[model samples]
Target: MNPSQNEVLTPSQLIFIVNGLLIGVGILILPNSLVKITQQDACISTAIGAVYPLYICLIITYISKKHPNHNILFLSKKYLGNFMGSIMNLLFLIPFIFIIFTVTPSITNILRIYSAEFLSPFKLIIIITGVCLYTAYNGINLIGEICKIIFYVSLPLIILPLFAVQKSSILNLLPVFGSGFNNILKGSIETLYSYTGLELVLLIYPYVNDKKKIKNSLLKGIFLTTLIYVWCVFITVYYFGLDLTSKSLWPVLSASEIIDIPIINSFRYLFMLSWTLILLRCITIYCFIAVYILKDFMKKTDTKKIYFFIYPILVFLSTFFTNEITRRNFLVKVTPIMVIFLVIYVSFIALLVRIKG
Candidate 1:
């Protein structure tokens, strides 16, 4: 359905949507990835790595502004012609579909390892995918509402990181910039996966009320996320040091354990609980984008049929990865390609649209 005026999202909702998608399971290992290469300068690396998502967001926003009434699917076919556009649609669709598979097992495993050992894998998969499907079937506006609710509610828990600073030694962050610009740059490249999900904006841009304000809204979202990432890295490095940060599987989670609040029996559990909400938001948004894209590509007015057919396959594919190594390998191998294709697809489509005009 074409978004009605009432369905249009405000800047705050847009920010919630973007930030929710951008911050997912990647945050857990981000400090380790940056510290492994840049050591104490991981924060600097995080700032630099943010440029990729920033640039991509600008490109998508620019394209959206030029075609405010149409979504990416319409723009692609209009500029690239049916055959090539259909090919591009399929290419873009792979990442959205694969994201469900990649994230489903990962989030489920995190719950199993850190929070809910009693929740069986089958139950976790069904509950997560089912909730996502039901949400997607309602439409993007509902997803935006869920995101707004989650974003505001999670503030208290997310701020728990501030308590971590008390346990950190400023000395641990000593000798900043010691990693050298080249090393920090290399580390920045490793953090690309953390910035992967902003492409969701391209699909949902038409739903945003103020098209002229998209660049401002997107930059705000990206900047906010950058602050969060740098804060996580700073606290983790300041507490754990480079050696320990590099060794920990999830430096942020380990760092959170240092917060000794009497009221909260375990800060780590609090972090995990809040993080599960964030991941659930991410998963739901991604599923909506996937079904939305397919529905548009197939020229269907409703997504109900597509949701039913696609989510079951998503459940089956998610189960294919039985262990952590396989999941890690799948992410490492697939993410770069998806990122590269996204860059090419957005740039090429934007260029074609400009030339034709």
Candidate 2:
């Protein structure tokens, strides 16, 4: 199975895929997390936080440009030697699996909280996991296509907060440098959880049709994601004020309650429904990466058998966290670990690749 025989991703599809990866269930809670630390300046914190992932994307793009048509797994093997590369690959795969556990449960928890409180987590996991497995087993091209569709479908919902802006108190953001830059910087840490999934580009760059466009696609995707994130934070802050936004579990969803559409009696439900798509898109990417890594490890071209075996374990693990607080704690505690691993792995590889050349 030559990589080229699989479908090639257009630059736009690449952008959507990265964007989908960046903006997941994180949006629902980001406002509260930032507000609690930064107060009225959460939007500022969001803008500052945006820089980190872009810098990461730039580094990834640099590496990918140096090794076009090769993914991180391949480069690690080539540059790090078989023994060391296999170790690095395992390091990468562990977090990829952890992502499935952390993100899948969080999304299911959100759906249960907002849409179906009566529904059990086990049932939700089964349904969501089934969909993710089906999508991932198809291959990168299908994931790219689904990501494009999810991106467009989610755009209007992402902007739905604009309708409530009139009700929002711009004055709520007074004393713009609230509690100084220190708190803003602290709040930026919260934003990292939101930006976690963009690292998918390390695997994605190889499958892109026009390698030259990778940089542009990555930049555009990050920019778009930052814009949406900032918008969400701004709307949540403006609509709820600092005190309410800080206290609220999910300021974005709570703020959506203000949107009253004649066609739909439940705008909040509609917003949550949109989130189902957004979250599913994110989960699918993580599951796909897991399958992708397993296939690479086994030297198997077809992932159907591998996916079947892995998907059930993913589903079972996803049900471990029974509540939102537990799910959030898992994300907060583990995100830094994954980020640290990614930084160390990429920096080490970059240094080695440079030294070797």
Candidate 3:
């Protein structure tokens, strides 16, 4: 079914929604992760990684233009047939489900370590998931609104890292490309997981008010995301140097800790508070997309009822990885696989659309 008037989003809202998704938990630790592989050239790796999303945006734009009325769910079923299409749709849901599983735990762990050590994981999970459920249940229009607000509110936090520039050493990044072509490529691959949320555009394309602007919106969103990521990695490496950044679990957080405002004693705390909202937006978008896709399969059920079932399962699954190491390891291993599946899935779908047309 097509989106109602209430569900339609403007081009700017679409940009913010995509940005909100792309800039979540990944930003917290990306500097550390990239530094481990690309050393001082982590920023370059980040720029390289953005190409994946750029490519996806182009492919999705083509597919959406060809089939203006249908999202990926209906498109899959239309071209691939009931059995194979249903299977593909089910596989499509895996990444969103995986995101919910991995991101919920990761966000809780970050909050506990950085802001709310006093609270238990279950309590934090309840708070986070509660907000996510409420937002997701409201539908994509509300989620888009929330994302736009969060995007503007969190925009200032982007410059918080710039406060560290005065103390940063330019020498840390001097030997650029020292990581070699192979290592840079590997680091770029590592960043593919961070760029996962861009695919949500495929699902939401039908909801955009100006379908013709979707391609520009996607490019702008990816461009904004790449700039933020590159800035984070560049600033972290400049501030901490290669050795220290490689050791930091959340280097961006660590970098923020150094920002000394006149009134605020701990900028890190302020950063975490603001960042928690952005993270919530990310989870909420994922939850909404998952529920939206599921609605296609469960045509008779209400969305709220689906969320009731989904949230409980999410809370239960999030409890599996009790510590940071396990959660990080699980994401590290699984994300690459998810990335591969998404690449193949989008490419195959796009190819089918081309040939059939």
Q: Give the TM-score of candidate 2.
A: 0.95
Worst 10 residues of 1 by lDDT: 295-304
Of candidate 3, the 10-residue stretch with the lowest lDDT total is: 159-168
- lDDT of prediction 3: 0.87
Q: Candidate 1 — number of clashing residue pairs?
A: 0
lDDT of 2: 0.82
Q: What is the per-residue lDDT of model 1 for residues 124-233, given as tens digits with 9 covering 90 to 100?
A: 88788888788867776778888888877776877777765776678887698998989989988888889888876877888888788888888888988888888888
Between prediction 2 and prediction 3, which has the larger TM-score? 3
Clashing pairs in 3: none
> Residue-wise lDDT of candidate 2 within 99-168, one digit each (tens)?
7777777777777777778988888888888998898777778888888888887788778767657776
Estimate TM-scores for all models: 0.94, 0.95, 0.97
Judging by lDDT against the true structure, name the best candidate: 3
In angstroms, the error of model 1 at 10 is 2.4
lDDT of 2 at 269: 75
Stretches of candidate 3 off by over 4 Å are: none
Instruction: Evaluate residue 14 in candidate 2 and report its C-alpha lDDT on the 0 to 100 scale.
Output: 89
